[model samples]
Each structure stands twice: as structure tokens, then as C-alpha cells.
Target: MAAQHFRVLARDPNTRARLGELHLAHGTVATPVFMPIATQGTVKMLTADDLEALGAQMLLANAYHLHLRPGETLIAQLGGLHRFMGWQRPILTDSGGFQVFSLSTLREVTDEGVRFRSHHDGTDHFLHPETSIRIQEALGSDIAMVFDDVVAYPCPREQAQAAMERSLRWAERCRKAHRRPDQLLFAITHGGVYADLRRWCTERLVAMDFPGYAIGGLSVGEPKEQMFGMVALSTELLPDDKPRYLMGVGTPADIARAVALGVDMFDCVLPTRLGRTGTAFTAQGRLNLRNARYATALEPLDPTCDCVTCRRYSRAYLRHLFKAGEATGPRLLTYHNLHFYLRLMDRLRAAIVAGTVHQIVDEMTRLFPDEPSEREA
Candidate 1:
């Protein structure tokens, strides 16, 4: 009945990927699900109803953002993020580690935690592992990530090694500090792209016995091969029964590759973020509605997708809305993209259950030809 429980129904013949069900407080979420990021308590233009219709059962929010804006107590007093944001589905809140790291200009990291001035105002504050845990518990997310030191791209071996070692210690502190039985705690593995370091961190976190695991320190100007290699190697070390999450990952190609390496859960800002910019993800590839190519095109975003956007709106109409800056356009596209991810995971699970994941991946590779775009180009 707890969120941490995972029941594996099937496994891929060629890889560690498996079909499984996760028990969460809001409901049961199928494995390989994409939890869209909703920092500051909203998924931008889309509502909870739209997300529910799009088949999203779980989503992600951030403890760091909420702590800065409006504060956690305000959200809790207003009846937690679910009611405060009008989303009743399950939510997983990230610890402030990533955000703190991102505020490099305003911060100094010590063993106690990170101290920085709020990017909003000039007010100073601090967030340690226990403090992050307390903030997430106050926000009442169904799942919470451990506070780990996240290093930027191309960090030195000495710095990366130090952070990696400290992260293991922090994971234990977070595990010990976490008091919510309803909220599952997931330890994050952070070691840049080093094989030995990934192994060292994974082994240490696994020994701490967290309910779930995540692969972090990626998507920050690293090569795709390095990211994929870290994922492949780290997933190998995670416990087989626990859920494996690839944080901030959700490109169609990214999900496809990660699933093959046995990652069961993903949370990313890409879908909604790209959707806001009038781009859409398709089995074939990503598309930009802002393109003049869509001006007269009457087909749906994806001819194969059954989302409401595909069922109703034409590419021409969507392109017009994006150009015109209509609010609904981004909302509808976001819904469609979320639907595509949830449906893709559904298909992945079914293929695994049917013992044809290899064929499925091969078929997906054939349909979606382009690999992950490493750079903006």
C-alpha cells in the first residue's frame, strides 16, 4: 500500500528493463512513466484535469522553488501543493540540491549545506539535507529526493570525488532524517561520468537502503554517450526490486535509451517546456509548430497519436495559435506531449509483458530515427 512497493510483472529479454506497477498514494502509476516537472506548483498552462486525461498519474515539483517563492508553510497552510495547485495526483518533490548548485553565483557550499541569496530578492537563506527533507515533508509530496551535492559540467576529478563521497554521507543523513511513512525517499547517484565513481556512489547509496534511486549529474553540457554510459553503469548497480529513476530526462530518444538500460521512472521539464515554445514530440521526432511549414498543414501533430489535440486540432490551427500567442495552444500541445509520453510508456510496458521489448525498441528506433540532440543545433 506504500509508494515504495514495486511489483515486477515482466522483464525484457535483452536488457534489464521490466514492466512493473508502482503503488502511490494518489493511485497506481505504471512503470516507465514520465512525471512532468511543475516547479512552483503548476504545470504552466495545463490543469490537473488535463494531466489526468493525458494519463499522468504522477508528477514532480521542487522544494527549492517553493521555498523561495511563497514558501512551503504558505502552501501547507493553503492545504498543500495538491490543493494549492488544484492537482490531486501524486507528486514527487526534488530536494534543493540541484537548485542550490545552480545558484553558483549566489552560493557557497559547506558540509552544513548551501547558503545563498534568493534569486528572487536579495534575502539570504540556507538549505541542508535535513532542511530539504523537512521542506519536502511539509509540502507533502508522495515521493521525495535525497539532498545530494550536484556538480556542474566538467568538474575536476578531485571535486567530483569529494562531492561523490559527501553525497553518500548526505544520503544516509536524509534517510535517517526522513520521517514520513507516506512519502517515499529516493537516493540520488551523482558522480559526473566516471564509471568507478558511479559504482562507488551507487554501492554506498544501495547500502543505505533507500526506497528508490535516481541517476543525477547529467544533462548539464555533457556528451550524450557519457550520459548514456553513466545510466547504463549506474542502473546496473541499483537494486533490482527498487524503482530506478532518471531525473530531468524525457526526450523521446532519451526515454527510449534509458528504458533499455532499466530506468523505470522519469521526470523532466522538456515536454512542457518545449510544448510552451510550440514544439511537439512525435514517434518520428520533435516538431516546432512555429515553423512556417505548419502554416497550411492540416494534419494533427502526430498522425498516430490519439490525444485530444490530435483528435481535434490541425497543425495549421496549432501553428496559428502559437504564432498568435493564444494561451490554449500551449496548453493543448502540452497535454498532447504528456499523452504521448504516457502512451509510449504504456506501449513499452505492454511490449515487455508480451516479451517483445527488443522488437519494440527496434521498431521505435526504426520509426524515431534521430538520436538525442546533444546540442541546441
Candidate 2:
């Protein structure tokens, strides 16, 4: 029998969201959680201790990048991802299929796998389902993702269907290749924006009975409504017992809506990326630290925030750091942004238990109003 790694603890009567627990080899992570993206074994400017301090339960790393540089064999020799990165908490490794499709310059996709040149050094490389599983196993993360062909937004109907079917075939191979008892493997559902294809893929993945399911291919430049529609459709078809992960999604509004649709896990680089660019996520929309308006402001980034950045530094000081190109500016904002995401998750779980998710959602919408044109993460 497959391992039973997830358990629903509570449900919201007003919405599809539920409070759940994912029991992993490393530890237990509360559901509706936001995992910081630690791409290349690091979460940008923050340290492992900083992540823990920010209330992060687990983090996401890219197997593709790690495989290209340090190589998985070296990581295995160094005692795996957790020890190597000094993060003892649960870690989930993405199979890097997205990178194969999005990052590589020249690529060819075949039944065997994807053949591509490294974006870093233009070296020849190939990644199949079996090899992806092997790499994740070597990394020894608590959760591993199956490699799937991800099509970009505005894809043709025929091409979307073909990619979705191919992803299913690769999923089966990943299931057979995965031998680690400690690692829970997740299958990424791909179907572009086609509802029928999405349904077909979800039902098929459910039949395979992987420990979890991830909703992929949505945030690749699709409209907000279409993306949420895909998420809702996929969640409707997924088993309630297993966890659901929404990959590379979103702003606060996006996360809240996905949670209401019963998504259990989320990972995105938006917070750190925006932070590095002198932007901060706040309850009252985004704050631009580079703006001259902040130069004389003596307030914290967010008055309600309790993060060290908010507690210690004033807006003026943060602005000064950014204006002068000091590295500390990005580091401070990164910490605050991570804290905000984790705190948002904590509040969501509480709202689910209290059956007040709708209220929370409404508050988030009001606080973070959608702009006329918003970009995907």
C-alpha cells in the first residue's frame, strides 16, 4: 500500500478549504501552508535559521539547478539536501521539468525525456522521469515531484492535450521508479487552460494514488479567472484525503482563493524576488521602497507587522539602503515578506478552523486590491 501522509484536521463550512496536516519523514507541516522557494538550495538572501525564525515549516528547492552545478551525487555524499542546506525542516524538491521547458535555450521533448542545453553553461543534459526520481532520491527531500511536460499559456488545444497525456505517461514512470520509503512523491497536473483535459488528468492521477497532487500550468500568463478556474476544477477532481499543491502561484489574493478551493500547499519566489527589487508585500497593497515618498517616512514597512525588519528598521532607513545599493536592503525585505506569507498561512488555518475563511478572504481582497494588469509569479 502507498504511504498515508496527509490527514484533514478541520473544514470550513463556508468554503472548500480545510485545515490539514501533512506527515512527512522530516516532520509534520500544517496544511494551507506557504513554502518559501529555496531554489538552488538557498532561499536567496535568508539563512536556514532565518527561515525557521520566519515560521516556515517547509521549503521548495529546484532539482534541475542543483543537478546542473553541484550534482546530486555530491549532495548525497554530503548527507542530502536537508543537512547540506542546514535546514532540518521538511524540504520538497521539484523535478525541474518547468526549468527544462522554461529556462533552457534549446530543447527537444521526446517520449524518453527532455534533451536540452544548460542555461548556465550550454552543456548537454537530459532529464527523464527515472533520472528525475533518482536525483530527488539522492537529495533525500521529504517530498519529491514527478517530472511533467508543462505547456505555456495560450497553448493550442491539440498541443495542450498532447502535453497532458505525455505528463500522465511520465507520472506512471515516476511512480514505478520511485523507491524511497521516506520520500512522498507528488504528480503535477498539466492541461493548460482546457477544462476537459484538466479533469482527465486529475482523474488519472487520482487512480494512480500518489501521495499528493500539484496544480501546475496555470500561472504561466493566463488570466486570473482562468487560473482560478483551473485550480477549482483540478481540486474538485482530486482526492480530499491527499494533499494538493499549487506550484509557483501567486500574490496574497491568489493564495487566499486557492486555499478556499482546498489547495493544501504553495511555493513561490514572488516575495523574495519582489523584495530584491525594493518592493514589499503589505496589507495595504505593495510598497515600493525606492519611491521618494518613503525617504522621509519614519514608520516601519508595515505597521501591523511584527517581523524583525518592521520592529527594528524604519522606512527611511530601508529606503536609504536600497537607494545606496546596499545588500542589507534586500535581505531585510526578504525576511519581512517571508514572515508575512507564513503569518498569512497561519491566519488561514485559523480561519478554516473557525469557519471564517470567507471573512478572511474578503479582508485580503480589500487589503490587496487587484491592479488593472497584474503579473503571475
Candidate 3:
């Protein structure tokens, strides 16, 4: 049977901030949501159950890493990616384009696709748009991305424009090649700061008719203004019925600002990756669990948070675990950080639904205007 389709639930009275649902083969997802990075088909220390408990209805997986590690054929024979990963919720797989771009020596981009060396063992590999579609089909993700050329940070206008054009052409090829009706293919817009190129990509994709769209290659070491411009401009041009995803976006501040500008989905590695190094997100501000100031602190990670990390543990204990090289330290911090991000999304969704998204943004900024970066809760 065909799966259910995306539905618009609400829209902010004052802005483009919208509330919607993405129905997939696995389940439905709330819009304006943050997808935790499960790069290797796992969100670091989190299990599927943990994700559900935290209200996470979807997640993002990495094609390049999975292709290198487990090999695609194995996942296909093992009942596709769903059984291999044990995640029953909706999953989105990125085309290997961004990953190949990052591996400078190993990759060469052409009009057809990218040719590159495997980062794992210097093995040769090739990834084209149609090829990416085939791989994600084997992975059986609910949402798959088009293979796109990602310009490196600090690239020239002409270079960025060239990459965006390639990305748009690739997106058309991907949409035509895609075979899974159950899996939604989202085209990416890769214009760096060139509004004209961004508009071109958006206009082209809207014509190509992807089920959804993504704003890509923005936060690649560009200044905050450029990143926001990429998002705001792309969001302005995208169709209202489809979801707008901000690919590889940034910190809490970045998320808040992008959400305000009407982005519907976000995926980033900051929370889990930073958690391992003792960085955590709190309502007050960022916290480094390893800080000496937390040595004797007894407060919950965040006073208003109701997650397990806050409901049960203290800052001092978590600090001790991290200092003592215990695995529990990273686990606790990861849980707290993910919980915080997920909750932030929930609040934003609620605000959009309630016709008070702008008010929520104002209140959040006023309340957190800079949570004293203090060790105190």
C-alpha cells in the first residue's frame, strides 16, 4: 500500500513558521524537528527506544560512512537498513556528496558525479546522483537526498555557482532515477551566498517537483550572516507545501534563528559529538561537564528539564564519571543534550501551532539572552 503523505497542521499567524507532519513508511514526524545524527545508523549512545521516549520521530543517517564500513550489499541482503539498524522510525540518508567533498585527496567532482578514494583504506569509489538513489533504496530509508556537490568553505562565487548548478542538475537526475514511492527524495539547494543561484536552485527544484527540499552547504565555516542568508533566501523561495530542511546546520543559536526564518527540519552532529568531550546544552547556557567548577555541584543539568539525566543525576556525579574515564559520563551528557534539543523543537512546534511562534522566539531570547555561562544551574 502507498504510505500516508505529508500534511500541513498549522502556520504561524505572523511568519512563515509552519507546523506539519511527514508521513512515511515507518511513521509520522512532526515538522520544525531536529533529526539527531545517527551517522553509522546509530545515534551514538542512543537506542531506538530512547529516541521514542524523547519524542524523536525521525533520524538522519550517513551514506558515505555506512557504505565504507558495512558495505551496501550486506545491508540489502540483511533485510535492508531497517533490520540492520533496528530503527523502526523514519530515517533519512544523505547522498555521499558532502562526505566525498570533505575528503580532498580522495575525491574529484565531474558533471556526472564524484570519483573518490575510500577514507577508510584509500580504496577507489564513485558516487553519482542515480547511484546515490540506488544505494539509499538498498538502505530502505524513508527520506533520501540527492547527490550534490558541496563547495568547500571560503569558495569563490563562481565556484559556488558552479557547484549549485551541478547540484540542481543532479537533483533532477535523482528525482527521475528514484524508484521508491515510500521513500521521499528531497532535492538540495547549494548556493553559498549568491541569492540568484539560490533562487535558481529553488525554482528549478520546484519545477522538478521533489516531495521536499533541503538548504545545503551553508554552514561550512561561513560567517553566521551568510549561513542565515542561505537559509532565509532558500526558505523564501521554497514551496509552502513541502518541508524545508537545513542541512549540516549549527549550534543552538543557529537553530533558533533558522527556525525563526521558517526552516522545517535540521540535522547536525554537535550534540552527540560534543557530548563525548563533556559539552552539554542547558536552558541556561552551554556547560562543559569537565569544568572544575562542576566538581562539587549537585544541581540537575537543567532545572526545568524533566529528562532522566536531570531527574536523577547531579552535575558533580557526571563530572566525576567523566574525569574518572567512565563511559557513563558521555552517555549522561548525550542524553541530556539530545533531550534538550528535542524539547526545544517541541516548544517551537507548539508555538507555531498556537500562533505565537514569534512570541516564543522573543521569550526564548529574552530568557536565555545569554545564560550566564555560569556553572550554577
Candidate 4:
């Protein structure tokens, strides 16, 4: 049997969407899955039990953060990320190339590797493809991403091409350096907003043939039309039998659109991030608990939601908590927001199977009135 395998169980006739299974070392992860971010080995404010309650099957962690903090060696000593975090399901770890470039200052990028100062302290650190693979292996995640040069949005075509070429070189090194047979190494496609360069990067990575693939370098301050165009082009070339992940993406509409383009996996911090700011996602649209409008509202955050927060509390009470500067406000909203995303994915998976993905997209459009205009291509 192959160490990593993806089998298509169903495909939508109208869209590129597919219902699939990702066979990994830890277990089988249902495709069209949403993996919440667990940056420091934990999905902030929510416990492992809370995750289980929400039916979360997988999560994403940052090897960069773990390696910088308690350290990957310590995590391995505690018996890998799964045991250390108490999450028995599949986990994917970013190679930290993005964080290094985005979060740190005084960085140098060469064909050999990237060197930058630690965001935690001012100390310098270097991360190359081989070192990234070693860090992920120590974490023992089910999936490890190749370290790639992620270029910022609106970059010059010349700079984009250079970044794409460098990413290709790094991917090859990661492919050769990855040692864990139990882990599936996935290559990331990078090329800013240039279609030709994006196509070139995808072709090169496909030739290298990593077990899985991720569409990176999107959602990086680019306009919606350009990002969707890139996603459409990237998905067109990626192998149908392998899982495709859209890294660090996005809103409900974003996920639905990517799924329509045949993406299988996603990870984002949007829900938790917004939840911390007293925002909640409802079927109608986003609701700000900080607003005085919800102060006397007796409705649940989302009448349709079955999450604990919705079942137990009202918008009035949640607004009161936030207005009063209570910590529980964020906690409750975070749980509900995660529940909303997971439930959205659940609906998407079902829609894929039912061959009604287009309908789901339209429904989400009506629900999020601001979305269609924003995602217009």
C-alpha cells in the first residue's frame, strides 16, 4: 500500500468539487475538511475536548512557533505533537518559511536558505529546506509542508518569477530531505499574481511529484479576483487523485469557492481572530457583539447553530460580557465561530456528495450580502 493515498469517492458534475478521503499514518481524514489553526500546539481558548465536541477531525500547527518556544526536541521527547497536544487526529505543520518572512525583520533569502531574527527574541535563526523537514519530523505530524518562498501581493513580475523559481528549488530539497515514511510531504505553489509564473511553478512541482499539494501565496493582500484566478489555474494542473490544500484561507465564501475549484483541505485563523474581537459569523452575515444594536436582542448568535454557545446563551448576554470586558465573551464566541466553520465544511461536504455545491455557494452569498461583490472576478 502507498504511504499516502487519496481516493475520490464522489465528484460534482457541475463543479470541480470532489468528496474524497486522505489516507494518512494517523487515520483517514475526510476531504473538504477545515483544519483550525493550533499555532502554539493549541487552538487558543478551546481545549482538545472542545475540539472533539465540534467534530474537528484535523488541525494545523506552526513548526516555527514550536521550534522557537519549548522546542521541537522537547515536543518529540513528549512523544510528538499529537500526544503533546492531546489531539489524536491528523495534524499538518507549516515549514515556517512564511512566518519567517512575514513576522521577522532583518531577513536574508538565498538559494541555500533563509536567515532571520526570532520574533520571540532578537536572536538570529536560519531555516533551510532540510532543517524545516527535520523540525516537522520531530513534531511527527501526518502532513508536512515544503518550505517555500512566499512572495507578497502586487509584487513585480520579475521578483515574482525569482521567488517562484526559488520555491521550486526549495521544494525539491524538501522532497529529498523528508525521511518519515509515515508522513506525507506536500509541496506549496508560489508565484504572486502572475498567471504564467503560477503555471510554471505548478508544472515544476508536479514534475517533482510530492504526495500532496497546497496552493500557497494567496490571501496575502491580493484582490479577490486575482486570488480566485490563481486558485482556478493552480487547481486545473494539480493531480486529481492527490489532495489539494488552500493554505491560510479564508471566509465562508472563500472556502466554498475553493471547494468548487476542487480544493480538499484548508486552515485559517479567521474565526478565532474575529471571535476575539467580538465578531460572530451567522447565517445572515457577520454580527458584531460590540454593536449597541445587539444589546437588547434576545436571539442566539445564530438561530440555526447547534453549538453550545448558541444553545446556552443569547446575543444580549454575550454583548453584555464583551461590553463588560469579560474573557468568557471571546471564549464563547470562539467556540461558536469554529462551530460555524466546521458546520459550513460539513454542509459543503454534503453538498459535494449531493452534487449541490453551486447551491451552497449561492446560499452563502445571500447569507453574506457583502461577499459576492467582494469575491467578484
Stretches of candidate 3 above 4 Å error?
1-4, 363-377
- Give me the candidate number with maximum lDDT: 2
Where's the lowest-lDDT run of ten residues in candidate 1? 368-377
**Mind sharing the TM-score for model 4?**
0.96
TM-scores of the candidates are 0.94, 0.97, 0.94, 0.96
Residue by residue across 1-377, what tens digits does model 2's lDDT show?
A: 43468889999999999999899989999999998988889999999989988889999998999999799999999999999999999999999998888889778999899999998998999899999999999999999999999888799999999999999999999999999999999999988998999999999999999989999887788888888899999989999899999988878878888899999998887888889989998877789999999999999999999999999999999999999999999999999999888999999999998998888788877877663222221
Candidate 2 backbone overlaps, count: 0
lDDT of 3 by residue, 1-377 (tens): 21236667888887778888888889878888899888888888888888888888788998878888797889999998888988788899988787787753557889988888876788888788888989899889998999999986788889989998888888889888998877888888877878888888789888887788888877677776766777888888887788889887656666666788988898888778778889888877778888899999999888899999999999999999999999988988888889988888888888887777777667556544532111000
Cα deviation at 57, candidate 2, in Å, is 0.1
lDDT of 4 by residue, 60-155 (tens): 999889999999999999999999999898999998988987888898999999999887889999999999999999999999999989777679
Regions of model 1 farther than 4 Å from truth: 1-4, 363-377
Higher-lDDT candidate of 1 and 4: 4
lDDT of 1 by residue, 1-377 (tens): 23348877788888778888888766777897788778878777887778777777787898988988889999989988888888877899989788777753578888878888877777889778899999999899988999989887898988998998888888888988999888899999988888889998899888887788899888777887899899999888988888998877756667777888899998777677778889898866778898898999999999998889999999999999988889989998988888877888888888777766676667666756654432110
Top candidate on TM-score is 2
Candidate 4: list runs displaced more than 4 Å.
Answer: 1-4, 369-377
Clashes of 1: 0
